[model samples]
Target: MSATDLSASPSAPARSRTVVASLRLLRSELRIIAGRRRNQAGILVLASVPVLIAVALKFSQPREGRGPDFISSATSNGIFVSLTALSIEIALFLPLAVAALAGDTIAGEANIGTLRYLLTVPVDRTRLLAVKFVSLVLGACFGVLVVAVTGVIVGGALFGLGPTTLLSGSQIGLADALARLALAVLYLSAGLAGLAAIGLFISTLTEQPIGAMIAITVVSTAMWILDGIPQLEWLQPWLLVHYWTAFSDAFRDPIFYEQMRQGLLVALGYVVVFVSLAWARFTQKDITS
Candidate 1:
């Protein structure tokens, strides 16, 4: 049958089949990401942060303000271990791992000469990029969950689990605390998705995977530095890393939504802009690599 005939014969069935196949492509991309040694290493490193923090806090007394408020109280409640570990890693480790994965997505394939062969498949460029972005987000969530779950296990064993205390000095049930932890994870994942989008856009600009990774990492670090400067306080709301710590608001009694809402909006804005840029560039750029 001609190409047109195959496409036209039972259009509804073809459309449904295509949708199913696209879903499978997302799984395939996820597997590809998870199967990578570097990505696995990144996850392991993320998981280890909580373990190390738990062990350290268990053996020694933390000075006030030495770290996040959760760190000072980590010895009191196991739940704080997860929050403390997240607080520690969010500034550097998490973003670095995310940048590594997202930065390598397209650039690595191109560097290894697989991008051309992959493009030879029936997948549209936009579909492929979308699948890749989804996989990156999934991979990031997996990494974050690893840290939280590991924190729970290690912290529970070391300090013993109990009800979580809120920043307002109010107590909450263990179940409620766990639910808040889940919310914190989701918020962090969403923020990391913005970074992934940024990295993906950077990936499309370079054929060298290492170059893309380094560039994104540097950019992330610069933003963090800018966010730290007192003189740049005015730029905080505009900076991507600015509202990252807003996840702590989840632990409050009433659960402060203002900062979290602003953070989510900022993250959403970054994802929209960068993902659009990536799609525009990837769809038009010549596949010479």
Candidate 2:
């Protein structure tokens, strides 16, 4: 081949590398999801748990005793209750799932002695980590969306969806009510992103996926324990778990702007810190499996 033609061919490959690498990673992740039956089942169960609880509670109690309107209770005076049911479980469950997935993402490859082969395929470490993180967050978001959508549908179907009278005895229309429910899900996603990052970070720290998953679960539950103790109320403002139920405030009359803002900041801060640490740790660590 002519020198000019050879140089042009080299440039062509370089230009296609990023797209090719991303597609390869995406396909690999899809394959993993398809092959791991236990994990797949776990994901379905996690997504459905909230809806199941809502359904059972709807049947178990009298309409009036079940508290005020489900939407208003979740968004306003019931912020804590709604959060306890939805957001808290997400904060705990999602990280555990991510840790289970990510802890094995690299180490599993190493254990199989496939990491070296994958590394030689021309994907940079940064790109690989970024793709993995993005995939994890996306999966988690999907899972949380499943919970939110199911809860709303089941809750509304059973309890009836219309203007819910708030604790203040004021009424909110169905349109505004649905809008607030949607916003609460969005807010919950932010928290889940932080959790996914933490899981990935823990995953990078160990070769045992179960260990990583357990660590994430334990940390989340511990925060919740702290949140429950009245003496540690000051710590609530700083704890990641504290904001797990914070999304419920969106349905309130005036809206719990301060709580919502605090949740956003805390969640985003956790995401930044966890991802930064994962990058630093994963990049420098020796890969022995």
Best by lDDT: 1
Per-residue C-alpha lDDT of model 2 across residues 1-289, encoded as one tens digit per residue? 8999987896897769877868788778767754788778867776576566665564554454444344335432222233335654665666566656666666556656766676778667777778778777777666666666666665666555557565445688767766776788788777777777787788778777667778878877788789999999888888876876767678677777788788889988988898899889988978775
Q: Give candidate 1's error at residue 8 in angstroms.
A: 14
Shift in Å, residue 144, candidate 2: 1.0
Best by TM-score: 1
Model 2 spans with C-alpha error above 4 angstroms: 1-24, 27-31, 61-88, 166-169
In candidate 1, what are the lDDT values of residues 205-258, reduced to their tens digit?
A: 999888888888888789999998999888889878888899989999899989
Candidate 1 residue spans exceeding 4 A from truth: 1-12, 62-66
Candidate 1 lands at a TM-score of: 0.93
